[model samples]
Target: MDHYAFTLVNGVFEDKVRTDPNNRKPPTLIRQPQLGLKSYFDGTSNPCDKNIPQPWDRLRDYVDVLNRESNEGAKYKVIFVLRHGYSLHNYIEKGVKKVNEAGEEVKNDWRKGLKFAYQKEVSLEALRGAGCEIPRVLEDHLREGDPNAAARVSLYDAALLPKEIALQIRGSEVTNNDAEGLGEQWLRWVAEDEFPLPGAIYTSPLRRCLETTKKVYGPVFAANPKKHKFQPIIMENLREKGNGDACNYRSTTKYILDKYPNYMPEPDFTESDEYEYQIQRAENGEPTESDEELEERMRKVLKDIFDDDKTSVVSLTTHSFSIGALTKVLGNARILDEGDITAFLVKAVPL
Candidate 1:
């Protein structure tokens, strides 16, 4: 069987590892963590707590064990590490309200127009003006003792409050349009007629990542209806930093920046209690593992995947820090700087 793996890392694929089965014991396949555990975003100060080892850490452990087990002349290999694609929320951010030089709050054009139209059409003055233009119609519409006129007036008044508020609220435009466009280009390149290999796909559970996967795989699946069915495995651990807190809108980089501007250069991952605990352990020469330890962990994970002789191909979909950390650990510090679609190929024999 042809083994191929493609991982989405830091908005692109950084490496691809493959191996052909040979005259050796088949390597064990390492199972990735469940999607639910990977995606959980508890907002404790240190998100990487004792109860929650970082995803990278878990991946590393798996790799280390695999390497140790395959010391008996087994071949190990790995392929493509990648980052998830742009998200819907990224687009939404572009449309948030911003103050112009005049200090006037100007919302997105669409929101502004919607607000203005709602206000103008529902104003008491508007109805009065309409009455003057259609006196006979108003008289005919409102019977001598009917309450329709008063009801209409009350409805207009009620709408006025919300309409005024909505005018102040800003609207958003698409933010990651460029990123998505680039992603599409990369997908096309990989699926060319002469493309080298068959590949598997994986991704983080975030909307942006899924959207990217869909865009990239849609055409492939269309062209090869039976051959290229994109099976995306959503790994929660691959999500962006602060995913959990950001989802609640209570504690996020944006929320913190808006609320506590003075805390610039936000504290390291150790700013959280869980991280602090790990730091304390490290200080004592007994480091506790946490998400902050993703880089080191990913190395082992990759190594383990490589050592698995049975699996020749695989792919991962992760995020920026995780991708950078993993690539750095894999002796390719410069890979972090490579643009989207960066790919690496590695071949190793049992040591």
Candidate 2:
């Protein structure tokens, strides 16, 4: 399937905020000049320039027209893709310290508390049996008589830190049209009508993505109970590209379903990590999932959505790498920052 991306604030449309050399930042709703200026499909025929009272209404009508006129084999879908809020893994990866809610520095750095990570449910005993070298941090924890210290250090399928949860709360406010002074709010731009509600919602089964999706859409679901009868569908393919990183490795289906009992899992969803990490590289090469594999997984997921869903508007909550691969599969290029939201007008061409 091919796609065309437009009207993007953080994705393709670059601006001073995103390009500032002194303090480069992601395109956030709180940032000024949100959503960019009203753009036109053609240079002359701006939809908002028409007699339409609301810019969003004009844009919606334009999209409706495009879908209404397109051939049956080629249908346009407005995919609202959002990268999940920063996870603990992200915090560790950046190796930056920030004051947390407790006013204490959140972990000195990734190396401070983290020596290495183990796949979900993999115990220190198992790793030791596999001849994995125990990190000093883990050894210190174990020496302290803490049995669960390895689990804490591993942080398998990382969860969002408190700051990221706060970020999601702010992001949700914008989604619910609660931004009063945060500059141009895209959801508010369609104040004449409720911004097009996502007909279907999908999310990575990873804990952080699921948590972020819930946090961001909690109000939306509450406001439009009829539109969102169920929680977002958990999709394995929406998971981040695997490089043998514990954070990229998702939890088991049982674990996820236990947390999100109402969320739908695809029929083929496996109870355990379908793609487990290969500890012995000699036999299986590197455990990392290649970019080509990631793109193919993305393509398969897109095809599944297009085939099963009739909704024109769909929403996805996933990781940065997953979103990047998805865009690549759709013939666009975007590497969304953590917690950033962007949309793409994708046309699924039956191949």
Candidate 3:
């Protein structure tokens, strides 16, 4: 079976490393348990086996293949991972009232002391007076319950409304829109200098990430028209962390608790099992396992990619949480900090 090894470093992949000869730095080998009979086969086993191979053996075989096939001449192939650009959610928190089926106000658990219906009506009127066209669908959704209604309104329709009201809301901000410049720089660095681009590009499903990818890649494809044949793969594994219901209490309360330690009431002097249960649920990937699930999903995607010798060079654009999980699964110590990019390179070898 063909062995493969890969490492992600600073947004570039190093498929094969050279020994200094005079000062040889032996190749690093990583080995872990194989789940079944494949464990006894040694590092060179059939790739088609359905059983899980030890992680270390997988890594060693990956590297060994590159060494043999290239006669020691192969350079590592880098894969870039990055977070999407900035967005309005970072700046302001605006509230809209939720209305029941009867069009009556329904108080949100997270937002207390605010009228559930009147606030949105007043805000909509204010926006209309300021030259915004409040979409009936958006208003209806706000009155009802729609997960992506807020995002859609903020991105495409907010501009039609009042500047002051819009100013109070948050929007995504792209640093640069020139795709050609970014693509040129990336190509030059990767092809000529053999250096990885400073960062990988990963984005959330939101409009901001899509916009960022379009702008950054536009110029690169423009300059090298042929390379335009390749496009990024959007993986659900790279999505944001918030997921809750209409009460709004789930995500917001957690955020508040994390931010202002003293805001919530002190733990009751009499602790109950329920208290521990709640805590455990919060810590045990409750509310949303999107990040963890994404990591495992990405691992499978990569495993398949490594199995194919013809596949070389690819990019993944996704969100922060997904990137963090991916980095950890790849053996990195911590999650990716905001706006950071990480790269990796994989090598294939005949074990």
Candidate 4:
């Protein structure tokens, strides 16, 4: 696992271990099996060795386990914009390393592209297909470049499951199993110690977001909506940015209602159609949407979502790419990984 250390002078976070001259190693991560604890590195070539313990002297040598649990990351995020947890489709994509204005590494809320194996880190060569096919996109996405160009795998070729089901890794078929341990992440980020109760929830109509809505916050809202001012609403525009089969295709409202009876759909919202034109274009290798068009629609969607409610706090469930659009609309945000929730406070700049 990747060990991390933080410089906290008097219980306040300062900088990551590698970035600080005083610390040599990060603190060790902690886990519990009864709670179904699992790390993002669970299925990779190398994962956390739970038997190991961090001695006080060597605390820095261990990965910073307390960081994720302390609600420290929560202080920065107020408007919770959550990405669905790991999915079968994320295999080819990796994390995007980013630096903030201060030039320090800004850890993604979801820790995308995180590799946990200590010395036995999974190598690209090891991930080669049975047919000796190098996962070119996965390779490029991990290695670093313009992500949009390098991070694509045809849904058909990837042999991925439906977008809504929890991703299974290796041979584990557990649904919403949080293969990357995102459930634990959600628990930390949304708990009272971290974020405030949401006033509303706006979700993508796709199965993954829908499933996430149930898995992540269902307990809080389902038990008592009035107390939290939480109401889950489905919006067609919240789906990923595409007119293609993947973005356009979705489960019927009846199917969703059957699964999550409490979810409320936008009025006048009806069935969805997989755009035949877009699908055909995709089949023939056409881009889903131009940057200009995508941004325009995203801005429109953001307008509707903001106009829908004036709640001080709200939770939004959507996909990765769309989250970029959200970042554009909301000042600035870190790149999101699956099942990652980024909460931030917002102030309206009246137009």
Candidate 5:
């Protein structure tokens, strides 16, 4: 496989939008097409420029120019990376138990959530003493009390919380009232801004991501009658950084196909979670799929996208950990909130 250096095209967004974690504002491009300021690709006061109706068109034209002027083995693409909506794993990560559809707490202790034990402050020795894995830990007491209990297993390929189904659906609605133009309603603004529809969509195989991709993009593609069909390809490497948690674990390819009959997974996709049973961590300073490994995996996926898809715009429905690696691979550090949709230009140069 080859590697590419991914560079972000800056000055197209507000400084705080990507740089400031404290900025609670959702980074939607509808209202601020050029971020309410002149972009590096701002149009000149010419007749052609004056005729353009939207700033997004100018931005698209700029990306075209960038690709045209770039050297060989280099291209510019606009990618909209959307984090999956709030999931059961997210709720459990905050130490909350699973809730039933009737708004009552699920007393099934076996369905408890997992923690990021590897990233926790505790030392590895301490974790080992407690027979802990990076993302999944079998506490000594639990092991001693009941070795085969359901709680021993973390969330199995976590699904979205019930309320998020409504949240994302509502967010997708277009609003005619300007007063209702808040950031949380991202899809509305996306439609308003005339953001280019993704020529290709690549999603993680996790249930939450699969569900988010369908719910979010189904309407997006439906509204555009002439656009390509809403056919998302489930790529295995697009999964989150594995932490040995069942949430990061994915379902079998057949199971996914049965659930989402329309999804076209990679030809070689297997019937089981390929990476679920692998060693998630390295000891004695050995190499593992932690920091560098995650970046490398993201690079391969990006390379595949660049090589296989000729689309100017691409969409990805993934998780925060995967996005973290992706942004790093793209030379970005911005983090996305749950259900947040962000777009940026990527300059990929083969290395």
Candidate 6:
């Protein structure tokens, strides 16, 4: 599979070939983004999952300063856990891996994700809105493209960046869509059922998470200017676990600030902390933290935040490793969708 890139060209989004990963040359035709989030990532183990951990169990993981309050001082604080929207890397990952209906790893049907991805979930509105033209040679991969495979018209933003753009092209496997139902489900809970508006958001310092934050909640915050736009704090701990190229790569601070001016970056934020993350992954070629280490970190981050934060509701956006790790500590695992947002109602007992 070719490593194609999507970039903004004079306010329009364009797709072109990017054969190498480490190439630092400036893009010739478009304003190539320095962020890895802008590029499609390569292969991985398995790629499709959309379920989440049970809310109550996750809530129970919250702790009190001491159990001295007769168990009444311990409980959960309301929170939302979400995954990043689909990415070019995700397109690459899902384009190759294969899983069963239950979303379990089946085999190396690597070619499956490729076909499905090329045949990205189709809708006329999305296609017509795609601002750029699809070359005839590339049209063979698309069902909607003309016979000559020459969708040779100018591809536009609306089409290139579809509202459903967050979702990966799944063809018949709309189960990902079913799993992604949390977006609407969360809205229904908030609007009709009267759920609390998010007080703040803490997300992985990845481009996709930031993008997802805007797409999923931007409209709500836009309507209510008083909340200061619920600026998401870029929490480093929330990034996906790994020392590999995919996990460690990040857009520069200038890049991120330019792309998302509204987001509140941590005072100490940096672009790529590859050295630090490599330290986290291992030392002297030996594995660093086992399950216990990850659990400890997960516990510490969640507990410290709950104790310090007075807000009624918060949200965390990051990758599956972090999500699944927390799920295992709390209970079992449910593969959450790329853009899914699931809520948990937690009440902290007074210390």
Q: Top model by lDDT, which number?
A: 5
Q: After superposition, how far is residue 32 of candidate 1 from its true place, in Å?
A: 31
Clashes of each: 37, 0, 36, 22, 0, 25
For all predicted structures, in order, the TM-scores are 0.39, 0.68, 0.42, 0.52, 0.70, 0.56
Model 3 — which ten-residue stretch has the worst lDDT? 28-37
Q: What tens-digit string does per-residue lDDT give for candidate 4 at 278-311?
A: 4333333344566456556556665564556655
Model 5 score (lDDT): 0.63
Clashes of 5: 0
lDDT digits (tens) for residues 150-173 of candidate 3: 332232101122223233332342
Q: Assess candidate 4 and give its lDDT.
A: 0.46
Worst 10 residues of 5 by lDDT: 174-183
Off by over 4 Å in 2: 1-40, 43-49, 96-115, 118-152, 164-193, 277-287
Worst 10 residues of 6 by lDDT: 2-11
* Pairwise TM-score winner, candidates 1 and 4: 4
Q: How many backbone clashes does candidate 2 have?
A: 0
User: Comparing 1 and 2 by TM-score, which wins?
Assistant: 2
| lDDT over C-alpha atoms for residue 136 of model 2 | 47
Candidate 6: tens digits of C-alpha lDDT, residues 1-351: 111111111111122322313342222111122211112211112211213142222222221222223254453444567777555445434432322322323212322222221232433233333322222332433434356443332211101123343333544544433223445544554455444566778877777677777766766666557744657787767766553323334566777778878787766677656434453423232234455666555555576566666665678887656776654444433335555554433333343
TM-score: the better of candidates 3 and 4: 4
Q: How does model 2 fare in lDDT?
A: 0.59
Candidate 1 lDDT by residue in tens digits, 1-351:
113232322211222322224422212112122211232332212132335244433333433344456444433233545544433222222223221221223333433333322231233344433221213323333333463554232211111111112223312422222334534554454454223222456554444445455555556555666655555554434444432222211123344335333223212312222321222222222223444566545654455455432444466555555665655554554222111333443434433
Cα deviation of 242, candidate 5, in Å: 1.1
Error of 2 at 109 (Å): 16
